[model samples]
Every structure is written in structure tokens, then in C-alpha cells.
Target: MRSYAGQPRPRPLPARYSRQELPKDHLVEAVLVTIFCCMLTGAMALIYSHETRAAIRRGDIDRAFSASRKAYFLILFSLLFGMFVSITWVICVLATLYAQRGP
Candidate 1:
């Protein structure tokens, strides 16, 4: 392509396979964040499971059922939180890439 001054200009790289790759550190950070969230969720589940079982063994059916319901809600919340973090991270990476290209 011709430049404004009549000189040949280099073509811009394609977005899908551009020379500018996402930084490795950013990818690692995202992965680490995801893993951390998962671990937290798992720990919470374990705690809830143990509490529910204990309540059940004590003949407190109401307490055990309540614990079970709480556990389900906690799991749902965890899933949503994790998804939000992951999507935000992806958006951040994409924004960084676009910014690097100078608008």
C-alpha cells in the first residue's frame, strides 16, 4: 500500500495470527487465578460436606438439610464468580493487545 507521501507502506498484521502474541506472564496469571478460585470452591465444598454429614449423624435432619441447601448455593456462587474472573481476564488481555497496536 502507498503511504501519504507516496512511499510503499507495510501491511498491518492480521488480528488472528499477528506477530504480537499475548504475553506468557499474563496467561500464567490468568491460569493461576482460575486455579486459586477452584481450590477455594473445593475447600468450601469439603467443609460443607463434613458439616452436613455431622449434622445428619446427630439426628438433626433440619440442620443437615439446611446445610445441604447452603452448599448448593455456595457452589453456584463460586461458579459464577469464577466465570466472571475468567471473562474479565480475557477482556483485559484483548484490551492490552489492542492498545499495543496504537488504536
Candidate 2:
């Protein structure tokens, strides 16, 4: 365990990859998408979130960050698509109601 006099000093790692900090998993957003938005995308988001968590556990920050980004975009897309569908349904329903009222 003695250090050799001829060995070079090891450089420190960057702060971002430190064990104290981890990439975002967006698990909460994934769950919210599952509960309130499209099931398909929500399920996909959940998968990505799980992957992110697993990568972080395995000490693979790059994979974790990639999975986290995927999950985030999936949640965003699911929420937007859900809102569009809901708004379109509401508009159609109101149009039908107004037509039936004949004024």
C-alpha cells in the first residue's frame, strides 16, 4: 500500500459525476402521467424512470441522465396529448349541446 515516488498523482473527478449528486429520475411525473394522462406513454415513462433509477444505482450517471431525459419528454408529451384530447372532447360536447338547444 505504499505509494511509489515515480507514480503520478491521480486527478479528481468532475463534480457532476460525484456520488453525492444523482441525475433526475422524474418518477413522480411518470406516476402523474399514468394517473391523469395517456396510459401508453405513461407506461413508457415509468419504464424509463425505472431505468434511470437502476442506472443511478449501478453508478452509471450517463445512462441515468439519458433515461431521465426520455422520461421527462414522455411525461410532457403525454400531458399535452391528454390535454388536447380532453379539450377537443369538451368542444365537441358543447357544440352538440348548443345545436340541440337550437339557439
Which candidate wins on TM-score?
2
List candidate 1 segments past 4 Å from native.
Answer: 1-42
Q: Write the per-residue lDDT of candidate 1 for residues 25-66, one digit (tens) a residue.
A: 122323343365565764565566566656545545556567
Which window of 10 residues has the lowest lDDT sum in candidate 1? Answer: 22-31
Question: Whole-model Cα lDDT per candidate?
Answer: 0.57, 0.87
Q: In candidate 2, how many Å is residue 41 off?
A: 0.2
* Alpha-carbon TM-score of each model against the true structure: 0.57, 0.81
- How many residue pairs in model 2 have overlapping backbones? 0
The CA lDDT at 74 in model 1 is: 57
